[model samples]
Target: MVKPKDPSENPTTTTNNNKMFIGIVWNCVPELKLLLSALLFFCSLITLFQFFPSHLSFSIQDLRQCSPFPPPSSPPPLQIQHPQLQTDNNNNNNIIQQNGVIKRNFNTYGSAAYNFILMSAYRGGLNTFAVIGLSSKPLHVFGKPTYLCEWVPDSTGNGSGSVTVSGTKILPDWGYGRVYTVVVINCTFPSPVGIDGSHGGRLVLHASTSGGGDANFNLTDTIDVLEEKNGLLNSASNELAEFNKPPKYDYLYCGSPLYGNLSPQRVREWIAYHVKMFGERSHFVIYDAGGVHSEVMEVLRPWVERGYVTVQDIREQERFDGYYHNQFLVVNDCLHRYRFMTKWMFFFDVDEFIFVPKKSTIKSVMDSLEEFTQFTIEQRTISNKLCYLDDHPGKIYRKWGIEKLVYRDMMKGIRRDRKYAIQPRNVFATGVHMSENTIGKTTHKTEGKIMYYHYHGTISERREPCRQFVNTTEMKVGGKPYVVDTTMREAAGAVKRFELRMIGSALLKTRQ
Candidate 1:
């Protein structure tokens, strides 16, 4: 009844109510927006914690343990520790210890028995391809292995391509009855594959028997394709045009694996004398087969610092039961490793010394025989025990082995194994004595051209080598004839002066 009497008054009251409600909402606008924003931020934080809890609560170690992917399977990169004798202190003892443990573990379980050592790929020619590796002798007992070349994309936006080719296992007959051998997997591509260094590809070698089902024996890690100078090609011309030209190096020495208790003084003398003989444009690649101890490293550190030597820690090679400190394997690896870098590569032992007669220099001898791809130097065996009867014992004992021990072993008609040098680019697989597989000719008639003095059993002898003194006229000792050969002794003074000039007085220090 009241609504019926005041219709107009009701309208005015409704209008006032509407105005008050709108004013209240306008006054509380900022607070409502703040509340909404706070709720949204809370929800966002909850979502972030749910999805990525490790961001706030995990450490690097924890994250590593929580990773879903498996660890890498490839063997750790070979550690080439340059001899930094100056900065090596007691603090490095801990580092050395760690390295010893690592080497032990690597030898124990780095690669399988069938896996390859020092694996690399190369383009032999436009149609011919090769992947060189050092593996067990039984690798080809079943049959030849299969090779797969996976090529990367070119600059023209072409996709990566792959080709599977049948391989021929070319094993050099120089394993010396050892377990490991050099396996050159020769693959003949139907068409020239784009797996050259210009395209940057990888190689996968599969170990398949005649019976098959041996895919698991495949090399787990892929070997990168290596070209001459790592594909330094002429952009204006075809890649094949520059492929034949190998990088130049005057001289390169691939030393045998150093093992056992090596004499520091002997090593020092060998390195110094060779450095003098090889001249400035020479490099020495030495492998440490558990023999490059701290004392030996100290002797070699200066030469390493001067960039004349490279010491590779191949102590892991001992883990494998290979031939004679893996000499064949190492030399083959070194051959392919430095194939492009060096023009002529020498294969010899530290106990031996390469000598050219005074009338002709090493350059002239090598130049004269440049037409031949490989040449074997005659081994003039030197006595390790015989000494001059007239020389003073104390003075002679202090001299270098080559200088003090001047007696040459006259073992006539004895066919001693010869050390040889090669044009590495032309050589496929090398050995301690020579390479059986080469693209060019090999000559063993290097009598007057070049020769080496083999001081057998002298490198490891720590004590004085003057076991017996013989008169200059005396010709025989212990059923073997000996003669005083002063060729190396006459040059000792010059070598000593050279060592002093290059390494200062450090070489004069007595070995502990």
Candidate 2:
């Protein structure tokens, strides 16, 4: 009555159970499963359509953030550099390689125990050797007999079995002008030999080359692990470098007072090469020696015609005659102001260049070392006592100094006829001391390359009669040739002896 009782009733419930059971037939259960799966699939598709684009946008943004684009560097931005840290990249504080034995004013550096290593090597039948310098500068072997190493083909394999060369044997001194060859003899300590001695480790070596002036002549050294010895080839971490010279330069500025026998083509080539070494964009104030410079100018006329060189004449001004050497420095400083961000000023003479252990340069050497390195390297050449191998005209005849001493009492005596200007068959023994005005006095820079080296020839070749007795013959200073174990001691002894004579003279005068 109450019509059909509520389905919640027991009979209705039974009917519902029967319907559920019946629904199992006709593939209804399978059909429901299929429907559920379809629904899930459709939902997934919709979610993908809604979220995929958002994910794609995020991915794009992430890619833009991490791309390999160079970021904006710090303010007084770092200078772009070359691989060698050679002076070619002059504007970049990055590359300052030492090519010759010209002492530089390094107002930085300190004395640290250096680990020197000497060995020889070969690559593809190219004769090569390795010499590790513990400190900077490798131009000491000059004007003297030096102990060096010979090359052995099977050198690397015969190395006393070692992986890390950091804690290797005490480095051998292979007097200057040599690198990367086997030590002719191995010893833990330096041998007291002839005038030239290897006190500090001179890892001298010889390498086989196709010809005489191949840059393949190089040194192989290991740096302290703590000093980032991971073979960094950047300007700061520069490794092996190829010397590539461009046909021309950005600009060329000649200097003054070069009045000497500097080769025209050679000087031009050096300017072009070094300008590129310091990093491609620069001008140099070259000091040309009158007639010699005119010839060079004619050769360079083509570049000038093309406006490649902004020939700024720093000459013809009121010259500072008293301190002409300092004037060179003035020209160097002026170069910086002429161009902003110019990182270097090469204030070398026509015949001079800064040297380093192997291929290292001033910029490269300083860049890699700690800022507080407080040792000074005074490059004293044995080339000439008063003569410069790369002598320009400005270097006055040194005979006057010797004559002043000789003629002090013998000006009018018969001794005058003995020799109007006595040319000594052999110069008297003398001590070699660097001028206090030289690099050792006023600078604190990280250890640098040897200041200069006279590779073309020896100082003996360059000396004139006026230079009767210059330093020594082997031209590479700051090297083994001039690295005298007894130099400092000998200098002190000489000073003491001079003082005694002076006091005795004073006492005799007073008694009279």
Candidate 3:
């Protein structure tokens, strides 16, 4: 220190002197400390933005490019809606409320609203164009419905026109309080609407009506115009050509909707016997309203595979409130659907057996009565429970229901309902028992020509049909007079062998 020390040799002393100088400066200016801290924080923020640019910066365009959010894992349950307002004569409005929302009563109004089974175009004679369908009854209290026919264009670009037609609504007296009915619309075009066999088109139905209050709506239906290959035009010749020939089937059976628990054995016998009776030129169309279960299907599958039968599953029709399985709706639909496919159409039930007397075939019976457009067949009621006393309880009971149960109801003067056959080409509308709106004469005097044996309530019986085996001398069963009638029982053996040959022996095997 005395000789003036060099800075390098006295480093600790110099460092301490510098610290002392900084301390003195910091103490004198407090602003210098604040300024340094602010500068340090600013530099740190700049470093953060430089390292993580995407995290700090986001744009609306990026959000728009992203995928949508996923839906919920499970859907909400359905809610059944009921009408809130009551309808009456004084109150005309048919308003319904659901979940605090107001809606028009489509079901009760029955104007433009209806459930349709089928819609098809019909050639009324040679020039008349018509549209027909089976629909739910439209109550006249609301108003008369107006119909408009719109012809859709075909592949040939021939049609695409509209015309207002006169709608003919026929609610047959046989509805039995059911809702379904028949609607036929006749279209009168201003010009020639070229619809024919080769050139096919479509028909659109536009319906509307006025109800009370602000209740006004429009309904529409579209259906394909069926081709009539054998239809004769006003200027056509050569009836022997392929397009001018007759339909494939001569006789067609339109069965009412089969429902409830049906015995497989009875069904098997019915199909086989009818197939044999109707011959090769006939076909059967069966509608299942919930009856053609797996067992019944097994009985019918063979004939269906052989092209003699067609089974339509109409079980969903039960949800709607209609006549006994909607039978009237079903028959009318079948009538128009197979109208041109067969010359004669039959309406009856599964339990009823159609029988022509010996020496006369079904074809002969029909040909003899060909002059009549419609003929009512006399129905002979057979006892479902009573059987012949001579029939072996074990052997005859093992046979088909129709084979063993041969007792006929002999109640005199009882007006039993009758089933009928129609030349489908001449019938406008049909019913379950018979048709009233036909073009030609209808005869109920079909005593010997044709008749059906109605085994009443036997089709649904699951238990043994021989509830009480009565002797041939017995006059009545359950107080109703009956007599031994062996008509169907005599033919039972032939029917059994025919069934075994057609469907195999599996169906005839004795049940455990």
Could you tell me which 10 consecutive residues in candidate 2 have the lowest summed lDDT? Answer: 416-425
User: Relative to the unseen true structure, what is the Cα RMSD of model 3?
Assistant: 16.6
Cand. 1 TM to true fold:
0.70
The models' CA-based lDDT, in order, is 0.72, 0.31, 0.71
| TM-scores, each model vs. reference | 0.70, 0.26, 0.70
Q: How are the candidates ranked when ordered by lDDT, highest leading?
A: 1, 3, 2
For model 2, the local distance difference test gives 0.31
Candidate 3 lDDT, 207-323, residue by residue in tens: 544332235644444444444432333224412232355878999999999988888878888899999899889999999998988889888888999999999998877766567
Error of 2 at 443 (Å): 4.9
Tens digits of per-residue lDDT, candidate 1, 1-512, equal 46365655687888998999999989999998998887666555544443454456454435435444443345655798843232233323222343454311111234335556554566655556667666656655543444554433344424345666666766764545356666676766676555344443334455544322254444444555553443533334535653666665689999888988888988998999999998998999999998898889999999999999999998877866777877766776677677777778998999999999999888999999999999999988888888776666666667677877788888788888898999987776667777777888988888888899988987775677778777765588779988788899898999999999998998797452
Candidate 2, residues 203-244, lDDT tens digits: the string is 224222222222333333322211112222223322222212
Q: Each candidate: RMSD to true structure?
A: 24.4, 29.9, 16.6
